[model samples]
Structure formats: C-alpha cells, structure tokens
Target: MNTDNGLAPLRHRNRWRFSGGTVDLHRPDLPARTATLGAEPAPVVLDPTRTAVIVVDLQNDFCAPDGWLAGIGVDVSVLAPAVDLSAQVVAAARAAGLPVIWLNWGNRPDQANLPPGVAHVYDPRGTGEGIGSRTAPSRAPVLTKDSWGAALTDGVGSAPGDLHVDKYRMSGFWDTPLDSVLRNLRVDTLVFAGVNSDQCVYATLVDAACLGYDVVLLTDASATTSPSYCHDATVYNVRQCYGFTASTPDLLDALAAARPLDAGHRTAPTTPKDSE
Candidate 1:
C-alpha cells in the first residue's frame, strides 16, 4: 500500500482516497468506483499532459438558437456563453498538448433504439422532434449521427488532433465507446464542459467518476437552459458526490503552470452577464 498527498491506499487494488473523497484509479482488470461521503476537498491541480477535456452535447440542437430547443420556445440563449468558454477550454487543452474530446449526443439514423420514455421529452411542443426526428421547417434531424443538428455548435468544434465520440445516451458511458477510448488513451483525468450542465454534462460527469476517472466540471463552460435549481443541484452533487467544480480560468492556470513559455495559453473570459 502507498499514499500521496494524504491519500490512503485502498485495500482494493486500484482505489485511493484523500480526506474528502475516494477515487478508483484506472486499471485494466477492475471496475472503478466514484465518490464517498466526506467534506469536499480543495480543487485538484491537474497535470495538463495527463488530462483530457470532454466537451459534451455542445451540438446545435442543444446550444444554437435556430436549433430544435429554440424552435420549441426554450430560451437557449442561457447556453450561449458556454459556447465561447468551451472554445477557450479546447484551445488551452490543445496548447498544453492535452486531448480535447468532443462527446456529442449522436442518435442513430433509423431511430430504432430510442425508447419511448427517452423520446417523450421532445413531445411537449408537439413538434414531434425527438431523438432521430427532424425539425419541421429546417428538416434537420434532432440528433442523428452525421446530421447538422447533432454537430457541435458553430464556435465549439473539433480540431484535427482532437478526438470525437458519438454517444447515444445521457450518460456518455452507456452503451458507448467513451470508456474504452479514454482508457486506451491512458487518460485518468477528465475535464467536463458542455451544454445542459444538469442533464447531459452532469450525467457524464457522474459516470466518469464511477469509472475511476478524476473529474472536474468547468462551471462557466458548461451551460444549461434548465431551471437554476437544476444547475445548483448538479453542481452540489458533483462537488459532494463526484468531484470538484472549477471555472475555465482555474483550468487555464493549471495548464499554464505546466508550460510557462506557451504564450498561447490564455485565461478564458468571464461568462456574459446574461447567463446564469
């Protein structure tokens, strides 16, 4: 058994713990565990070289004004600021030589797998647009694998070296290749930023924790049109149950510390006043 920075070695082969939480470090043979009950610890200082920023569900159907949520009268403007913040995180991650993984909700073309319970959320406006369903006027699929609505928003996009994974469920790990991808990359730390902080982002964050990945939630870079309470609950849950929450600026500082000579490493701007 070994310890570092007050973390006690676990009786289990791969788990470790500090005063506040437990994290099952990734290993090939065993499944990972998430968090435990205790006081939250100070935010983690990440090793930029070993971390990856996961931009989740930043797709047009979730973030853009002309997309499905907007067409249904949802005020997607609340999610607008995250677009730029996520771009900043991506840029910083790339400059630091960290992988930026875009994990978007990409449904199947035939709509064969979407369950009724999962499809009911889109029926509120009677637009009939749900998973794999197209919008009335523009005819874009709600979230088809290769369709426009499922693509990352205009400003938040994938770069040549960045990774892209299409997820089918709210939790990116469910029936997806996300776990294997991260494990294959040997990435143990995941920085999460994306749309609907309380929904898709939160789900993925929790799943990552359970899978033995150190998780960080970028508060400003993750947007949600859901009620403020939902956002608050997600943040609280993540901090108390999964991992720490941070801003884009905090992550930038950590990355900068790792590479002081990189002039391209810059702090992300504060989110606009209109955002919650």
Candidate 2:
C-alpha cells in the first residue's frame, strides 16, 4: 500500500521504523500489541532517553467544563476518559524520565497572529469573541498565550523538567520550535496524548512523522468530540499513513518491560484502563 515514504530502513529494527526521513510502524515486538486497523510494519526499539510524550491541546479551554469548547456548546464530557488517560500517561512518562512536551493553542496577546478564518470558526457570535477575545458572560479570553485558558488542564500539567510549545495552528510544527527542540534533545520517537484526537492531535502526529520522528498515538489517551466515524477515520489514517495506534496500557507495558534489562530501554509504570 506504499505506507512508507521511501527512506532507508534501519539495521536494528524494533516497533518503530525509519523511511524517507519519516517514522513508520512495524509489527511491534510486545506481546500485547495495539491494533492499527491494518497497516504494514517494521521494527525499532524505543529509547526512553531519546523519546518524548507529546500532550496535544489538553488545555483548559478544550477540556474544562467552563472552558471554550463547553461554552461553545460542545459536549466536553466526551473527553473525560481521555483526560484521565492523559494524566496517567503523563505520570508514567514522568516516572520513566521521558520528556513530556505539552503542545497547546497559545495565541499571541494582540491576536494579530490568528488568521481571520481561524478566528471566525470559534467566534460565531460575531461579537469580537475570537481567539484572545474575552467572552462577555464569563470574561474568559479564548486562548491567549500565558492565560488560564491556554494552560494545561489541572490534572495534566507540565512537570519542572517537561517542555512546553505554544502552537498557533493545528499542527505543532507550524512556526513552532517543536521540531528543533525534539532534534536538539535527540528525540526521534514521540508518544502522543491529548484532546480532539481527530483534529489537533492528528495534525501534529502527521507533521511529526513527515519530519522523521517515530510517532505512537495512545488511543485511549486522546479524545475527540467529533462523530465516532471521524475518530475511526483519524485512527485508520494515522496507522496507514502516519504512524501507529496504541493504548496507554500497551505503551506503559512496553516501557516497563524495557526498563530492567537495557539502558536503551527505559520506564513507565502501571496499566491504563481501556478508555473506550
């Protein structure tokens, strides 16, 4: 199906494979593997020291009941499981000493950087209620950088050692230092978790894969308010074209297994309940 992007395969393969400056998923070595609908596989072991967990757009505005999404009438409760799973993933990743990068929609203070079309999508009232614009009733600014709305949700916060990237677009790489930061830290494998699985999270994963970073989507750790079919499509697209789909438990088990015997393999703790 031409899943790979035409890069040379790695000599020592594990669950993640490299091709044409992008990351590809191979049949994972772990006994409990996450389903990917149907995608071809190669293999590469995950290096904890060189891996990162990317928490995408799990901010107050998107996750909290009083936040933007809720205020806009979207059923925010759908993300409850995802929020819990994300917290667990963060906790485990932190314990494992893996870098946790929180990628969020943190727009500029002046809102000049927000494109009109993007602003219009969220500001349906035409009442100056746009990105960085304050809602009249609650006075919550849409998602200004450094604002409460832009902060990571209470349960899933950035640890002292974690990194934060304020992304202005759906894709984390757009005018953001995410790519450079990962390269600088020598992080080639990325585990994704966050809200709106079919949107922001999906966009960022695709970008990460295209930029040559191995990507894993913790399915249970991400949620989307979109229809069930939309979520399915996103997962299928990721497995077939971008990367692999795994539950938090699958990844945690893999990390735990790798910790004891090999320095190349690091940590993660506990199993996640199925979020589905």
Candidate 3:
C-alpha cells in the first residue's frame, strides 16, 4: 500500500488534521502513472496522475462568433483549431485519470473586482461597451458570471469530474482558487490548451511555471486572434524559457498508452537532451 508517511487510519496527502496526536500527511494510495510525448525543445514525459489539463478562456465570449471578441471585430474563426484540439485533450485527460480544469474569464456582474485599467482596455473610449456592459443587441453582459457569454463554447463538453474556475484577470492563479485547488488535487504538472495563446494562455502557463508546476503548452491546442508572430513567439518562449511545447497528438498518444485506451497513438519514452 506504500504507507510510508503516516498512520494508515489517518493518512491523507496534502491534507492534515490534528487528530489525537499524530497528523496524517501521507498521500492517498493513488497509482503512480507516467507517459512520454513527442515535444519540442525536448520530448515530454510526465506523471498523468500528478498532472492536470487546464483549458483557459475558451468561453463563448472569446471564441464564439457572436461573442465579445467578435463584437470587438476580432476574428473568432481563427480559434476553431484550438477549440477542437482542446476538446480532444480534455476528453482524453478525463479518461486518463487526470483532472480537467476549465479556467474561464467569468467576471463579477457588478465589475466590483475589475481594475480600472482592465475596464478601459475593453472599452477604451468609455462608451460603456466594455466588460459587464450591456452593449450588444442581446444585452447579455460580456463574460458575466453564469451568463451565456461566460459559458463554454459549443464543442467543449464538461464531464462529471471536471472542475471549473472563474477568473477576473488574465492569469487564472491571480485572485482565484486555481492554485489551491490544484495543490489539494496533488497536481504538480499543468497541460494548457486555450485561446489567445499570447495573452491569457501564456500568462497562466508562465504563472504555473513560476509557481513550481511543470508546464506543457500544447502547440496545436492553443490559438491567438492576434498576428502569427505573437503565437510563434509565445511557443518559442514556452520552449525556451517557461516549459515544453508539444503537439496535441503527442499528449494523446502518451495518455492512451499510459492508461487503458487501445486506440491512441503510442510512442516510446525518450530523455530530453538537457536532462541527459
């Protein structure tokens, strides 16, 4: 049972209670799982059990045709690839026993927590077409909590074990319970797939790395409405500075072989040059 930490009757990983005298800081009896992915700058090999997949800001407001980005004249069609790959990654993660977290930009209805600079950037002219403003014809507030604009896009489905976190800022960790949730789940690695590769996605991934979580950015599973240069540099920096960058297929291949699936692409584990 690998009961190496505490008394069997009171052991818990990342959890403790002052029971009688001894506390149970032992991690639960979860199976240790690992897999390898074909990645850039290096191949990726990670523990699926200690890892989580975070889909950031793929909400209707960011990717839907009639949503906030589109309302602001940003072409949302460019997000199709990201949406598809993210959906696939999320499904595979659920099957692999890895947690799937949807980090969406669902702001407070009153915009009480929204900073003035953020509000100005949304509606620079102060014309009331910004976040939480009923500027659109349908009058649904942009990214308001529990609003249609804050809902997941059509193709992204939520399963029973999936976790959802709403963030007011670009980084999901800031002013959110994201970090705490991940820690309690015993997640040490983050696989990110989402929109605005250079913006929210990048910010979250960077913060994840800074906070000591291993980060993997799925290249094909992320997209940016901005120019190609922004997307290119984001990937480059992820590999060069933050973490590794791998394709969606690589991740899926790793998960399938690592767990029960028999139909996923498979690859042998390889050591990255730097690690060797």
Best lDDT among the predictions, by candidate number: 3
Over all chains combined, what TM-score does candidate 3 have? 0.86
Ranking 2 against 3 by TM-score, winner? 3
Count of backbone clashes, every candidate in sequence: 0, 9, 0
The C-alpha stretches of model 2 lying farther than 4 A from their native spots are 1-44, 260-276
Worst 10-residue lDDT window for candidate 2 reads 267-276
How many times do residue backbones clash in model 3? Answer: 0
Q: How high is each candidate's TM-score?
A: 0.77, 0.77, 0.86
Residue pairs clashing in model 2 are: 7-19, 7-20, 13-43, 13-44, 14-43, 14-44, 15-44, 26-41, 26-42
- lDDT (0-100) at residue 70 of candidate 1? 83
**For candidate 2, lDDT tens digit of each residue in 1-276?**
101122221212133545566665542232221222221243345666567899989888888888877887888888989988888888887676667788999998987777777778777677876787776224668888877788777566555556778998889998889987787556678989897899899999998999889888877899899998888888888878887888877777766655442333232221221111
On the 0 to 100 scale, the lDDT of residue 248 in model 3 is: 94
Note the Cα lDDT for every prediction shown: 0.72, 0.72, 0.81
For candidate 1, the lDDT comes to 0.72
Q: What is the lDDT of candidate 3?
A: 0.81
Question: What are the candidates' C-alpha RMSDs?
Answer: 13.6, 12.1, 9.6
